[model samples]
Target chain A: AQSVAQPEDQVNVAEGNPLTVKCTYSVSGNPYLFWYVQYPNRGLQFLLKYITGDNLVKGSYGFEAEFNKSQTSFHLKKPSALVSDSALYFCALIKAAGNKLTFGGGTRVLVKP
Target chain B: DVKVTQSSRYLVKRTGEKVFLECVQDMDHENMFWYRQDPGLGLRLIYFSYDVKMKEKGDIPEGYSVSREKKERFSLILESASTNQTSMYLCASSSHGWSEKLFFGSGTQLSVL
Candidate 1:
């Protein structure tokens, strides 16, 4: 079955510093990877996705993700973290058959000033 | 903007009672999904529907059933609510493309006693 792994349960970053949330996925054939963010008591919002083409994909809120086929990773990154950037991040992958999305265990990012 | 609306934001039910979670999408999306969110575990897909009346079981669909009588509406039903089933339920919708991003509504926090 297609699955995703989020290695870090929590990441503490000082404000204005760079932040990285790690993700890896297991799937047959080329994977359709995605990143999502959820605030407290809210549903998830789409961050970005890696379907094809360039390795680096940029999305809303100045966030970007790098897709590395060799490493089997799609890590979410932000150049400078802010207090508002703190939230729960999730990595997901669509199975090759294209029916559903399998999500990882989630990473919580805490940006403190 | 694409809008997915879940009928309830919070629910409390007794064990052995039937529970219903309703969702509707305004963009007329071809696909709708139901997912449960817990603390450590990310989003676990319970059911998904590709089109009207074409539903498919997801990774964790054992105790849940779905109804998609209209293209814009999708409902998740729990025949016998249990304590273990209490969690945050999220509804999402997207186009038919596998790589398309999903738009989510505010989740329903269901508590079964």
Candidate 2:
């Protein structure tokens, strides 16, 4: 079965600081990885995805993720995070031939001002 | 912009009551999914439908069922509401490819008393 994991339950960082949310996955074949963000009362918004292209995938709101094949990890990164960046982040993945997308436990990011 | 709309933003119900959560997508996507979000547990897929009147059981589908009578609408039903079932419910729609990103609704916060 394909599964994703977000090791950190919560990550705290100050505004304008570099923020990173870690994610890793386990799948049989090639994986299609994605990142999503959710505000307090809103649904998840797509952040970025890694299908089979460049290792570094840039996404919305100045966020990017690095897909490390050897490490089996896709960690989200923001060089400078704003206070509004505080939200819940999820990492999801789908196997090359699968129809369902499996999501990680999730990581809560708190960007203090 | 793609819009996936959930019928309710918040709902409060009592135990043993049958609850219905509605979702509709403006985009003519082929896949619609229902997931529940809990703190530290991320999003767990409850059910999904790929076509009208076709439904698939997701990871957690013990106490839930889904209906997709129309191409643009999907409904989730709780056989009997329970406290454990209280959580944030999210609805999403995506096209018919494994690499397609999902568009989500704002979500419904359901509280069972």
Candidate 3:
């Protein structure tokens, strides 16, 4: 079965500093990866996806992710984190034949001002 | 914008009560999903439907059922609500495969008392 792993339970970053949240996946074939953000009292919002091409995928609110094939990782990153960027981040992957995603145990990002 | 709406943002139910959580999507999506979110567990899929009247059990389907009578709506049913079942239930929809981003609702926080 396809699965995702998010190593960190929480990540703290000073505001205006760069931030990264790590993610790795195990799948049967080439995977379709995604990043989602959830704010308090709300459902997840889609941030970005990596289906085929372009390892460096840019997404909403100045966030981006790099898909590394060899390492089977797709880590989310932002150039300059803002206080408003603090939220729960999840990395997900769907196997070649699956229609559902296997999500990582989300990472809480606390961007301190 | 795609919108997935759940019938309730919060619900409280006594143990063993029959509970139903409704979801409606307005984007003409072909896939609908029901998931339960718990702290430290991320989101676990309970069920999903690829088309009207077609449903599939997801990773965590025990103690849960689903109905998709119409293309625009999906409903989750808990036959006998249990305290352990209490969690945030999220409803989402997607156009097709997992490569497509999912549009999620604000989630229903269900408490089984």
Candidate 4:
């Protein structure tokens, strides 16, 4: 079965500093990776996806994710963090020809102003 | 913009009571999904429907059922509400393709006492 792993439970960063959330995947064949953000009392919003293209995929809210095939990692990154950027981040993936998408445990990002 | 709307924002139910969580999407998505979000468990897929009247069991489908009579709507049913079932329920929709990203509703926080 395909699965995703988010190592960090929470990440704290100062405003304007770079933010990174790590993710790794275990699946057979190629993988379709995605990043989503959920605000307080809100559903998740799609940030970006990596299907088959450039290794680096850019997403909404100035966020970006890098997909590495060899390492089986898709890490989300933001060059400058904002207080409003603090939210729960999730990394999900679907294996090639798979019907279901699997999600990781998630990581909470706290941007302090 | 794609919009997925869940009927309730919060709900409280007693044990053994049947609970219903409704979801509707404005877009004519071919796939709809129901997932439960817990504190550490990011999102666990409960059920999904690929077409009207066609439902599939997800990873955690025990004690849960689904109804998809219309393409635009999908409902998750809890046969008997239990305290362990108390969690945030999220509904999402996506196009037919496997690489497509999902659009999620605001989610319904269901508390089973």
Q: Over the stretch A1-113, how does candidate 3's per-residue lDDT look in tens digits? A: 88999999999999999999999999988899999999988899999999988899999999999999999999999999999999999999998677778889999999999
Better of 2 and 3 by DockQ: 2
Give stretches of model 4 more than 4 Å off: none
DockQ of each: 0.81, 0.87, 0.83, 0.87
Clash count for candidate 2 is: 0
Q: What's the chain B TM-score of candidate 3?
A: 0.98
Q: Estimate each model's TM-score.
A: 0.98, 0.98, 0.98, 0.98
Q: Residues B1-113, candidate 4: write the lDDT tens digits.
A: 99999999999999999999999999999999999999888899999999999999999999999999999999999999999999999999999987899999999999998
Tens-digit lDDT string for candidate 1 (B1-113): 99999999999999999999999999989999999999889999999998999999888998899999999999999999999999999999999887899999999999999
Name model 3 segments beyond 4 Å from true. Answer: none
Give the runs in model 1 whose Cα sits over 4 Å from its true position: none
Q: What DockQ results for candidate 3?
A: 0.83
True contacts kept of 3: 0.80
- lDDT per residue for candidate 2 within B1-113, as digits (tens), equals 99999999999999999999999999899999999998888899999999999999999999999999999999999999999999999999999987999999999999999
Clashing pairs in 2: none
- DockQ-based CAPRI category assigned to the predicted complex of candidate 3: high
Model 4 pairs in collision: none
